[model samples]
Target: MPITSYPFDGQDTTETQYSLLFRELQDTGIADTYGGPSFQVSATGAGMTLSVQPGFAILRGHAVSSTAVETVTLPDAGTSSRQDRVVLRLDPAANSIGLAVLQGPDIGQTQTDTGIYEMSLAIITVDANVTAIDAGKVFDERRYAGSHVGIWTTNLRPVHPRRGRLGCNTTTGRWEYWTGTAWTDLIPGTADNTTRWNGYTLTVSTSTPSGTPSPDRIWIQPTS
Candidate 1:
């Protein structure tokens, strides 16, 4: 029970048209913001399979500074070939290291590497794309809605708990969500000032869940 600009953007519009307009915006919301997280793993072994299921898992650089190592850890993908996302934030100085993500089924599998310009980050969309790019910016425009913060967890499933709820999938490593119609992944990488685990919407909408998400569900996406 609150007022939003979207609904009243103009008065002559019908509710049905507004609903369609809202849906279009909802679908693109996540792409506009970088988001997601999960269980933490260490950056110490080469070709070791971290115990992350078909969901998400975090890989800590431990501020990993060694630049001579040659192997990267991967998840035990087993037989599904299901892509799992990894939210990686290299120690700003994680340069020149033989760093990369193990792409598929085996430890000796293929992998994707990243190029962070110092403090940059990315939301890697796993599977078909095997892509890696800089994290997107989550515009901080919800201060009055409530104070949203970063996420730290041991188990993360279905990065987006509900439809239109966009997020960074540690399992998919990209902006994604279940739209109650289909699963969608947004643009890879992020904009400036997007250094946390939340997403941003293109604009505010009352139809969408804003002003702090439901319990256990955090709104990683923010809007301008």
Candidate 2:
């Protein structure tokens, strides 16, 4: 049992739950504020700034999708990483070319002295397929044949796109999920959900992952 289990368990393993209760968090709740894409608004490569429609300004996808990235890679392999802490700022009405700024630390490096410098970064307007979402305007994350906005957090932001399902945020190492209306945490190790700790989360030999694990790792016990 942990912070909350009600937020991270449901889906009876035999139901056609159409309500999307397992959409991933588009952005992490950390120091970054990701507000923004259905497609590669800019281009589908490195050094390419992404944009999206107004309402779909922020994007989210399956937490564990193959496209999930830990750090923004540059158009060139060794040129330079977009840096982990850099936040993408956008404003449709800003005159300084898309209200983009260069700030934040370089991750494993000292802070830059740019001091809020503006650049002509990629500008995102709107898309025809994806409907725009206002703050708290509840829309289905997997609705229609369009893209939904999301963040690039460092975990498996899987898109079960259905309601009343369990979800885990690996970065913060917690399990909470959307309850069709709001988010709920499935307090760790509840009832039969027991966790074994031997210096670290241990494992039974011959299982999948066999060794000491990070405390933030999520483990599900199977019932036979």
Whole-model lDDT per candidate? 0.33, 0.31
Give one digit per residue, the lDDT tens place, for model 1 in 119-169.
112212223322222122111111011112223231563444444545565
User: Could you tally the backbone clashes for each prediction?
Assistant: 26, 36
Writing each residue's lDDT as its tens digit, candidate 2 over 1-224 gives 55422233662531112112332333311111122232112332333233323222221211211223222222221232232212233222341212132322222322122222221223222222333312221121212222333333334454443244455656656666545555456684433333455544433333456555665555555554
Over the full model, what C-alpha lDDT does candidate 1 score relative to the true structure? Answer: 0.33
> In the order shown, what is each candidate's alpha-carbon RMSD?
24.4, 19.9
TM of each candidate vs. truth: 0.16, 0.20
Candidate 1: which stretches are off by over 4 Å? 1-155, 188-224
Indicate the residue-level lDDT of 176 in model 1.
58
